[model samples]
Target: MANKNAPFHPIIYVRGYAMTPGEIDETTADPFCGFNLGSTVYRAVPEKERQPRKFIFESPVIRLASDFGYQDVYEEGYDILDPEWEADPDNKVPSRAIIIFRYYDEASRLLGIGQTPNISQFADKLRLLILRVRELVCKNPANGIGEDDFRCHLVAHSMGGLVCRALLQNPAAEFRAAVKHVDKLFTYATPHNGIEMVGVNIPKWLDMNDMKNFNRDYMAEYLNIKDAFKATGRVDWLPEDSFPSERVFCMVGSNRMDYEAALGMSRTFAGHGSDGLVRIENAALHGWRRSGKNKGSAGDSCAKAFAYRAHSGFLGIVNSEEAFQNLTRFLFGDIRVDLWVDVEQIRLPKPVQDEVLAGRKVSALYQFEILASPRGKLWYLTRRTAEEDSVACLSHEEWMQAPAQRQALYLSSVFLANRARVNPRRRSLAYSMTLGVRVPDYEVDRRLWVNEHYEGGYLFRDSIILEMVPPKAEGDAWQVKYAWQGSGVSKADTAIDAKLLGDSRMEVCVPFGSSGSPGMQGQLRFIVSLWNKEAAGN
Candidate 1:
């Protein structure tokens, strides 16, 4: 029997888009669609000359079953849709099961009359499917699961994420009560703001063959969101009141070159700052604000992470370890921390300051690199860099704004498993994070500019070490230790200071400098707090 207090729940996997008829036919032919697809290779660095390393992942479907005791509901090559299958007299379904929302089956020639429905239709079907799953799991007494305790997590990839959103957001859709059954939603490379091709939003006028499903205007209508056509404005794709944004996780893909689709034309048209298809800016659901006037609004911020994987294929975000770790941790992990960097001051070089003092039009672009690794692990839990992955870009003007009101750069949402700690008996968690500030190039007057001597394109960087120990009993304060790398021969060689600020909240200032040199004077304000797990609905 499963642990009564355990957070383990059923997971519903939704696959992505199938562009062509052949692709749809091939997808329908598969038993698990793309959820069963696994990869044996990965590239540590996004370089053409570097060969990918051999890392075997037994797919999400197999991993969930092998690692967590989750099972598929099929029996002897028979699916729930099979006519011969009937409900057991006990009215029980497995506590942990995976249900693939085969929304594209009817579009395939082998299944139906090759007629595809719009996203709204798919969402309507999703509502019914949730009801079906609830009946199979909650209503069954033999499962020993209560109706109030029955909930499932939705894991979707690409356009399938939009389908999940529509089911939860669209008011016109039937089966409204089914939305309550969804506990959490995780999306991989979803275009929440709609896809753009060659710097153009796929025109809404092109409705032939359901091409308009990707149009922002058309999506707004079906997803029931307001202000979808705002080109340079913010749009909230997920409804605010329907579900808490904290329970939603968006896994963004940054490596565009590895997505070998459409004879390499897909990457060409999608351009840079994307996962070869969805733009990095558009990949996440909206309403997440770190600062400014909208800081404390309900459903304002959702958890998100950036990976170097592409949208799909061998290097796809869904098939990578980065995505898998994030998925499993978000669903099962107990501890959470939301990190942000507030720029207190940005000191420029003497020459650059002189140019600005002389009324010369000068602007510098800075990219923020972040990497997090747990103790006793060589691989990073999350990585965002300038060269190979998602980099937060800001201009000099943006940095000089008021520090309090200025928007804070979101670092990463770190989730640590209580049982997976280095020393489980100690009830302590240890992790190190490195933040690199890079000024790759600057613009004097919106022109191509290059620095004469650039060392690895980094202007400043720092690494932080954090150790956390939550209180075992209520009313007791939590304990945390934080230390940063100081200038020395090595991190261990330096006399570091580990400070404890109260219990739940702490503030620290990390000075940034170049590699092996300490002169580029700038400091980043870090505000670390223990995320409210109860309020987050975890």
Candidate 2:
């Protein structure tokens, strides 16, 4: 029975790392202790500093897309409640997480019992926290909450992201099934890769239970490490397949703070490009290699924000507006963005040449090697099947490695520098020179070419192996021969001559021009044709 009247589920935001008692305390702090500890905490902060409290655009449509409101209890001190919670009194937004604690003593007594530490232990507690939120929604009744109609989105910061990853990637099928209802997940500086800060010389007595040690060396493959740490229980470091990549999205920060010693000189430090504690790399999904200003050409790429923020301080990552906006976008809107372009319609800059042309120029001619493969043979066969009968003869070894199509042709671009020009008109100019390209069989039309130029001539032998010959020798020469074209005079190679401008460089009026043919004009593409030919003796 589908509940057509069921409203959208509320967003459940999760915060990370409240390992300290003073940090998690929302009550009055010691006034005469010299410093206000509450003012310095990272996780517990104001509204504007937490989520995107302000928007660039003011219109309703734009506001909905970019709307970010601060919604945490301990972090905000109950001053500003969620607008969704107040407006309808129906749709409620809650923040929660499972608090897994490490057992330190023989009785495995819970640390900070009744305190924040005790409350935060057990990942199951985080689940319960979320469930408690759902119960609140159900109590309102006006929120359209039903037993089977509740769903929620998760937005976590730092260690909160790690807990989310563990829940989603946990290998236990039962655990996954419990929260399989979760829809969207957004993390900021979660350190999905691994946390390196634990190695810092923090007081051992501070966390005698030592959960940091477990995270440093064995978060990815946690099962083995956990088993070793325990005497006989089900020792698994990361829950079996706990946090699968697809279940979550992340926004990582990179803080640009000075190298200061406020936290202690010996504290294990994070990367220079970190949001104070979580390195940008670790904060994101591992193996999302694409970074920097450029985005991917496809729709379904990863979300990464490398911003500047301190590790763990008052004005750190949690206090940044940019981090909040990116997080909101990834969670509420479609994560995937698309980009389209026609590769064949793109053009390259013209090749650069500086030296004045002479009837003869000094240059060297050289040859190159060809690598054949089984896949290569298939490439040749598919493209040139009509001419297969004529060029079909190849050795078993060559056939094994040759491309199926005759497109394994190799090509090279020639760049010249400092060529002295001797003009009968006046003294030679000291201008730098960048000249032409030399290819095998100026009349040939193929994608891949092995440089095989003999004495600056345009001729190819019957051998399947074609090698490129160099244009110049070791020593510099005065005379130069710049006239050379790709392809032959046969009907099969007519387009080759029309496109060849003698000098491949001269073919480009623009920069980086290859061949000037209409086929190679917009799309500077070349297919390498491969043939498996028997060796002379074989």
For 1-538, candidate 1 gives per-residue lDDT tens digits of: 3224236777899899888788899999998998888899888887847998899887999989888889887765666665544544432467688888999999999987798998989988888888788777865555676666667899999999989988887665354588887888999999888889998888889866576778887887877665433533334456565577878999999889998898888888999889999888898875533235654332446778888889999889888877888888888876766667655556666666566688776677777888987777756777888776488777776765663454467777777776567666877776788888887666666753554647575666678777766666655655655667643322222222324365555554545545333124445454444543443333
lDDT accuracy of residue 275 in candidate 1? 91
Estimate the lDDT of model 1.
Answer: 0.74
* Candidate with the greatest lDDT versus the true structure: 1
The RMSD of every model to the true structure, in order and in angstroms, is 4.1, 23.0
In candidate 2, stretches whose alpha carbon ends up further than 4 angstroms from where it belongs are: 1-8, 24-121, 197-214, 221-247, 256-268, 286-302, 338-538
The lDDT for every candidate, in the order shown, is 0.74, 0.33
Cα misplacement distance, residue 350 of candidate 1 (Å): 0.8
Give the CA lDDT, 0 to 100, for residue 59 in model 2.
21
Worst 10 residues of 2 by lDDT: 381-390
> Pairs clashing in candidate 1?
91-140, 287-300
